[model samples]
Structures are given as structure tokens and as C-alpha cells.
Target: MVKCCSAIGCASRCLPNSKLKGLTFHVFPTDENIKKKWVLAMKRLDVNAAGIWEPKKGDVLCSRHFKKTDFDRSTPNIKLKPGVIPSIFESPYQFQEHSYSVMDSPKKLKHKLDHVISELEDTKESLQNVLDREKHFQKSLRKTIRELKEECLISEDTARRLDVFCWECCQESTE
Candidate 1:
């Protein structure tokens, strides 16, 4: 019943723990080709165990191996999309030292920082625009409700006047 991340370096267990919150375990794909692809990818990560063992149905890979893009998150519960494969891995370091060599150079680090700041500013602007649109919609809805109430009042007043006029005319004709 105990589930743990199948990734070689990951120690994430699927037990209820503060650190492991939101983590999910995924079963190996049922399709033969996809299963083979997953097994190959796992083998690549576990170089020592390569070609030694094959993954079966009961074997599971944890969420850490996948990027957010790898899963379809439109539904309440996230699901792996059909034909999509997990390529990301949970290594010891957050990022591989060789890949993040830009951090070692002052100029490259500054450029990366600037790029991150620009992205953050763009995201903030986009969020503000969405909030403004929601406020406008709420104002329009309130105005529409007020207009409907006024129209209803006018309609009731017209109907009452017509009824009184008919009563007067009927009384005169009877006289």
C-alpha cells in the first residue's frame, strides 16, 4: 500500500506529509509502445540498472518526474494526457550545475535576472487587466438590474392607469 517515487534520486513518498503535499503517484502506461518508452526513459536516468529490469503494470512513477505541461489540468483532478510522455526528472540539485553555468558569469546572471523581472512585470500587467475587466462586468450587471426594475415599475403603472380608464368609460356608458 506504500507508494514512493520511482525516480532514482527522488525520496518523495506518497504518504501524508507536509513536505510531500500535492504529490501524486502515476501508474506505468498500458500501451506497449508507451510502456517501452517510459521504461527506456527510466533506464536512462538509472544508468546502472539499464537493460536489467522492465517496468510492469503495478510499477508507478511519481509526479516529480513530470512537468506541469505533461499533465492535462483542465479537470478538477489532474490527469496525464494520452500520448504525452514525462521527460522531466527530479535530480539532486534543482538545476544541473552545467546547465546553470550562466549563474557563474556576472553578465549572464544579470541578463537572466532582467529577463525574469520582465516576465514578472508582464504577468502583473495581465492580472491587472483581468481584474479591471471583472470590475467592469460587475458594474454593467448592477446597471442592468436597476434598468430592469425601473422598466417593471413603469409597466405596472401603465397597466393600472389603463384599468382605471376602462372602469371610468364603462361607468359612463352604463349611465
Candidate 2:
């Protein structure tokens, strides 16, 4: 049986007589939670709300809505990791035009700010770890240099005493 994309405004359809090759429809995940998340994401994109938003067993979301990073494309067959939500959408104008208006909502602004703050904290922690490692390496290098210098001084003192003793013995033998 032929299948078609169920995403809103998508006109893709699969037919037996079609000349196009390698076009495959991906069914929504069977897991109820995952399916619900996909439905929520779709609802966000559907400005018109033309039809029932719920997805059923046969409903498919085409590859166009997803980014390359969303799928594991290394193998022959494309696969999505479990719990991965499709966030990328085709409407750039809607986001660009209404971004400020959307951000004006207090709850959304707070949520976005919280996300940014969390990311900044993670970066700060990582940078601190790197600095701590560098400090440890510097301390070890200084200790090694000090030990080597002490060894060199001791060797020099021993060689000097040996040279004096040999000179005295030579003078006594000559006499």
C-alpha cells in the first residue's frame, strides 16, 4: 500500500508509479510518550489548526522536518535515537517575524533565560576543571626542577673534593 506524509502543509505522497527513488516514509514512534511529544511539537507548528492534531498508527512525519543531526545516518538505514524530539521546522519567517513577540511572554522569557543560565554554568565548570589541571601540572614541573638542581649541586661538590685529594697524592709521590 502507498503511504504519504502526514505533517501539516506537506504535500509529499508515495505512489506505485512514481519515478522518484529512495524516498521512504517514517512512522511515528509507537511509544505513547514519544508519540505525545511529537504531537505537541506538531501542534506548535500548526498555525492553521486545520485538522485533528493527534497522530495514529499509520501517521508519518517526513524527513524534511528533521535536521541531519537528528538521525544516525552512518549506517545504511537511518535511525533516530530514543526520546529524540523533532524540533527543527520549515517556517523561518514565522519564527523571525514573531520572535520578539514570543519572547515578550514572561513565562517563555523566563524559560529561555533559565536555559541560557544553565548552559553558562556548565561552561564555567568545564573551564574551572581545565584551569585546575593546568595549575597541578605547573606545580609538579616546579618540584621536579628543584629536585634536579639539588642533585646537580651535590655531584659538583663531590667532584671538587675528589680533584683536591688526587692533586695532594700526586705531589706526595713526586717528592
Best by TM-score: 1
Which regions of candidate 1 are displaced past 4 Å? 17-20, 44-52, 90-175
Q: Clashes in each model (backbone N, CA, C under 3 Å)?
A: 0, 0
| TM-scores for candidates 1 onward, in order | 0.44, 0.42
Which pairs in model 1 have colliding backbones?
Answer: none
For candidate 1, write residues 69-165 as lDDT tens digits: 8888898877888877768765535434665422467887788799999999999999888767765655665465556557785465565565466
- lDDT of candidate 2 over 2-113, digit per residue (tens): 6777765577676664325545567898888988888777654434666537766787776766766777778888777668787755554555556653446788789989
How well does candidate 2 match the true structure in TM-score terms? 0.42
Number of the predicted model whose lDDT against the real structure is largest? 1
lDDT of residue 4 for candidate 2: 77
